[model samples]
Target: MTLRTATAGDLTAIMDLERTSFPTDAWSEPMMQSELASPHGRYLVDVEAGRVIGYGGVRAVQGSADADIQTIALAEAARGRGRGRTLLRALLEVARERGAREMFLEVRADNPVATALYASEGFVEIGRRPRYYQPDDVDAVIMTLDLVAWAAHRAADGTALDAGACS
Candidate 1:
């Protein structure tokens, strides 16, 4: 029932969530460990009753602030009750705080739920790449969101948009 900044110690649980939530595209343990340890990325995790339930992270790059919505997954038993939205906003907030004005990500075009969530957050469909996701050969549709307003709104409203309405 709480959200906190992610730390290296959270990797084991984070990896578990990744494995279950994104079976085909989960980050390797080393990669999650590295990103959690990174000085360049901002990671936020949701924990409930001492277990990691959800997490999201982003890294700023170049001058454009290209960001990767590294991972977002709620523990299977923890799904529903709006945990995902809260985790997502927490990550976006951190990204903006770290000088990210714009963010980019690729999602499976067929994931209408995720697509709608991003769209609600002001992420617009920009372009697409054929077979961006390997093995399954599923295409990834690129989406971009302007964090300037997202930041301003949160600052101005201060959680006016709660965990249930991130998208």
Candidate 2:
């Protein structure tokens, strides 16, 4: 799949995937629209054959010491193919570009696949919010990544920290 910057024009397709991926607690259209319009927000979508298969977003300000990963979701058909990792890494790179020294996110405790992906990427559990997910009553596993440490690991592993720009 190819990755590129997400735009407001991608809203409908993104909302479709967002609803499908998080049926119980998908974000409302207005909220997403605001996020997409925010100057501090960075979002990306992965497309294949003109279909949106995955998307990720982050909230960061230039020279900030910390950034928060807003969301990351993939179409059911895109799982098990490393698209999540691709999107995640891209987001991290974007955060670093925006001058973030660290990053954070909250993943559903019930999601082993996503949790594993985060763990493999050097995100360590820093805290948890009890029953943070409504309806399902799932806990939110809070994770954080030290950009400096992650970058050193990437360099040691021969992975470019600045993989690519969002656009």
Candidate 3:
């Protein structure tokens, strides 16, 4: 798989996977379009044999105290191969580069897979939003991470916290 910064052209494929991944809570086309064009957001796509199989994004304003993980999704076939972690780590790196001291995200309370991924990356549940996911009545699990601490931990473990790690 090849990982790269996402471009506007990747929106169609991103939306395809978005709908598949979040059947009940997919963002509208206009929202996604605006996200891709936003100066504060950084989005990425994972390609395999010329297909966009996964994507993730984060919103971080320069010098912001905190950044938000807007979204992260993988194709059904791409699950359980550590690609989700890779995409997440990439987004965290983006947040750090933008001078964010902390990061936050909301995951579906029913999705243990995603929650575990975030936990493994040093995120901790800080709160929850009741019925944050509409129609399904699923709660949203809010999680946060201290970027400085996370980076220090990764560095102490001899891991490169660089964007090049996305490969």
Per-residue alpha-carbon lDDT of model 3 for 1-167, expressed as tens digits?
77898889999999999999999889998999999999998889999999999999999998999999999999999999988888888888888988999999999999998999999998999999999899999999999999999988888988745774554
Of 1 and 3, the candidate ranking higher by lDDT: 3
Residues 31-143, candidate 1: write the lDDT tens digits.
88888888777677787788788888777653446566776777778766777777777677666656678888888987887888888777899999999887778899998
Task: Assess the local accuracy of residue 146 in candidate 2 as a C-alpha lDDT between 0 and 100.
Answer: 98
TM-scores, in order shown? 0.85, 0.96, 0.96
| C-alpha RMSD of each candidate structure in angstroms | 4.0, 1.1, 1.4
- CA lDDT scores, all candidates in order: 0.76, 0.90, 0.91
Candidate 2, residues 1-167, lDDT tens digits: the string is 78888899999999999999999999999999999899998889999999988899999898899999999999998899989998998889888888898999999999999999999999999999999999999999999999878878887888864536546
Clashes of each: 1, 0, 0
Runs of candidate 2 exceeding 4 Å displacement? 161-164
Evaluated at residue 39, the lDDT of candidate 1 is 79
Q: By the TM-score metric, which is better: model 1 or model 3?
A: 3
Give the C-alpha lDDT of model 3. Answer: 0.91
